[model samples]
Target: MLVSRGQQSTLLNRVKIEGRGLHTGAPVAVTVNPAPPDSGFVFSRTDLPGKPSLKACPERVSETSRSTTLEDANCRIGTVEHFLAAAAVAELDNLYIEVQGPEMPIMDGSSQPIFSELEKGGRKKQEAPRLWRKIEEPVFVREGFASLVVLPEERFRVTFVFIGPPPIGHQVVDRERDWEELLPARTFGWLEEARELREKGLARGGGEDCALIFSSGEAAPPYRLPDEPVSHKVLDLLGDLALYRPILGHFIAVRSGHSLNNKMARKLKEGEAGSNARKMFADN
Candidate 1:
């Protein structure tokens, strides 16, 4: 079980990473720096004028196609799940991300690269206590065959079920495994989808080096773990949920994608707002 920390934390040192965008194929550079307490995760577009910034929040999410994208009137950022996942697991309370392109660098197609950088930067505890959004009641959301539920729990946990075609058959991942085991699991796609994705102006930077390509009933191995794809689904789920405040709950997901995950995040944020309002009224 993942227990919540009592105090909030941020990076002790700044870290930088450079790579190509997974979808845009554009060269991108990111600098992760520590922010003041309660600053949360803020992404600033250095490539744009005035360096417009957007805080990582469910209401700011503009797109959930294949990946999560955050946008505001002045700037936009794409494919942020991997970075957010790393930050969440690291228990980082505040960070300022400076982006030099439209999307985040898709390093090794997993959260491992970002996680490693966070470790190198080290963690520093702040003065304020962590603002954890504890699940007092169950929250559920669904999209077609996909569904996600958050139940009251003492610690953070995720159980994911991935159902796909042929070589990428049925797979299930539960809380038995550690979060580190899921870090190296790369994103994946069918070999046939490559061309179509490129034609549609997506996955331009994707390749065997950055993602696992399944062909002829087999994934291009060696595998990072037993079921890498399912592990990645869990990673994505955690990242999407990070849009809300730190949570203490058991997340059960079934074939849920970014879209459904974002919907659940928005719901949680709304619930948190209502909760805070009630507490304030009672205190008054």
Candidate 2:
């Protein structure tokens, strides 16, 4: 009895981008290829000779400390959340992401570039409608001060909450979903964390240009919007939900990050206990 929405669309053609990872700093070239209906989103690592490919889904998420990474026991790709977000926002169901490195170029540290690329690729509707995974019940999770609460809703929606040190101190975001409002939210980091990352040679590629860096709790560039942090969290959630393959139910976030996001994603996919909401409203 569940119905989907939107027409399945992909690039009318292929488009490509070459850059460096925001974290790994590795050189990378990623090509976006339009796919057939119901193909879903798939990432192929052309850099690997064997040409290992992984489906962009919660089950494929192997790591999420910095960004959502999709992988399997044999192969993997890192920091793909933004690109995936672009795909989801566009409501494009089928895509082939061919990459030559571990991370997609951190271009502007937002989904802007990816959005441009998606447009360049073009869109064409298929015969089928985009199915939605409407939450029939609520799914919740929490860790310390961070928490995630997803409740059943008629259409796709997201709510975000963030509370940390200054600069990003705290914020909340609420909206139905729009490309303009969501696409502009950029990635941010603290100065000390950025420095430590550099010393450890982890996110060496990350800098002021790719990500907004706050120094000692000061809004480095000043926030584009008051609730930018929460907006970005909503943005992250959108990208992650794209893996769900259709319209998603309501998603809520409270002081949550990639770690908790991935955990919830995995639980949804695995249908872990309490993850289902059928019983909650069964009688209603």
Task: Write down the RMSD of all candidates, one decimal each.
Answer: 2.7, 2.9
Candidate 1 lDDT over residue span 8-64, tens digit each? 999999999899999889899999999999899999999988999999999989999
Q: Given candidate 2, what's the lDDT at residue 163?
A: 81
The TM-score obtained by model 1 is 0.93
* Each prediction's whole-model lDDT (CA): 0.88, 0.77
Specify the poorest-scoring 10-residue window by lDDT in model 2: 272-281
Write down the TM-score of every candidate: 0.93, 0.91
- The parts of candidate 2 lying over 4 Å away from their true place are 217-219, 272-284
Candidate 2 has what TM-score? 0.91
| lDDT score, candidate 2, position 76 | 85
Please state the error at residue 41 of candidate 2 in Å. Answer: 1.0
lDDT for 10 in candidate 1 is 98
Estimate, for each residue in 129-211, the C-alpha lDDT of model 2 and write its tens digit. 87666666688887888899888788767777778677567687877756556787788877888999899888878897787
RMSD of 2: 2.9
